[model samples]
Target: MGVIMEMNFNEDDKYLLAKKKVEKIKGFYGNLTSFILVNIILIFINLYTSPNHLWFYWPLMWWGFGVVIHGLKVFEVFPSFGKDWEEKKIKELMEKEKNNKNKWQ
Candidate 1:
């Protein structure tokens, strides 16, 4: 089995956490830009090449869904679920497991 490394986070780690969020937002914007450009080109091509069928909406709908999810993840809407939430959940589960082990013993 591979060794598992435990994460030890400190208050100073907030900066690193913020940096990661910034990176995520940056990536989301890049993806959004690409989505717009590619979809626009696809729309034009679909309009000119196969105007009867109009197949561009297929990729547009799917890719637009992805962009919306990416936006939610980057902006942390609805269910944010940040680092603090993760740490709290970890501690809660660890305590619960410890208690269960003690009860069994």
Candidate 2:
């Protein structure tokens, strides 16, 4: 059996919190860069190998489909994490942390 405990956060509660936020941003930036890189590589390969007049069109079609998927993630259409929501959440978290530290000290 595992023991669970809840601890209080103090003014020095900076390490984990800061690390988590940095990790989150790192993850998003990594995903965005990787996504763009992969699509660009695919587009370049298709463009270079295209032999027919409409061969370049094939990559465009495939890229269009990828764009739709990326758009959904960016806009958060279904997961409900649109731009405003994300911004508000970040602001709220910062305020909450500030409040907590003030109260603790």
Candidate 3:
């Protein structure tokens, strides 16, 4: 009885952890998509305006930095909320789940 009860508790914990990680990845990807769209619109608007008004180009350089950051996040080269961190969390959750299954058996 004691062993079975412990196994159930562990499995529940693993499920909850996995759920949280999935939610986090969803939110991160949503943000990333939105950021890309906004960057595109801003660039188009800037290029459409007059050539004498050179104020927007400076912000474009900053925008390029943001693009680089987002690219890194997308590629999983950096620890992003969607990619690296989520992968690590999922691995940990799976290991926990596997251990719980072993205990049940």
**TM-score winner:** 1
Pairs clashing in candidate 2?
A: none
TM-score computed on alpha carbons, candidate 1 = 0.74
> Highest lDDT, which number?
1
- Per-residue C-alpha lDDT of model 2 across residues 2-105, encoded as one tens digit per residue: 22223456766767756765675566566667667876776677767763433545655676676666657654576657645665666677777777788889
Q: Going through the candidates in order, what is the number of backbone clashes in each?
A: 0, 0, 0
Error of 3 at 99 (Å): 29
Model 3 misplaced stretches (Cα beyond 4 Å): 1-9, 51-105
Instruction: Give the lDDT of residue 80 in candidate 2.
Output: 59
State the lDDT of candidate 3 residue by residue for 14-93, as single tens digits: 89977876675676677667766776777677767855565565655676677667566654565567544665676677
TM-score of each: 0.74, 0.40, 0.45
Query: RMSDs, each prediction?
Result: 6.3, 11.6, 9.8
Candidates ranked, most accurate by TM-score first: 1, 3, 2
Backbone-clash count (model 3): 0
Q: Residues 19-77, candidate 1: write the lDDT tens digits.
A: 98899999999999999999999999999998999999999999999999989877878
Q: What stretches of model 1 exceed 4 Å from their correct place?
A: 1-11, 80-84, 97-105
TM-score of 3: 0.45
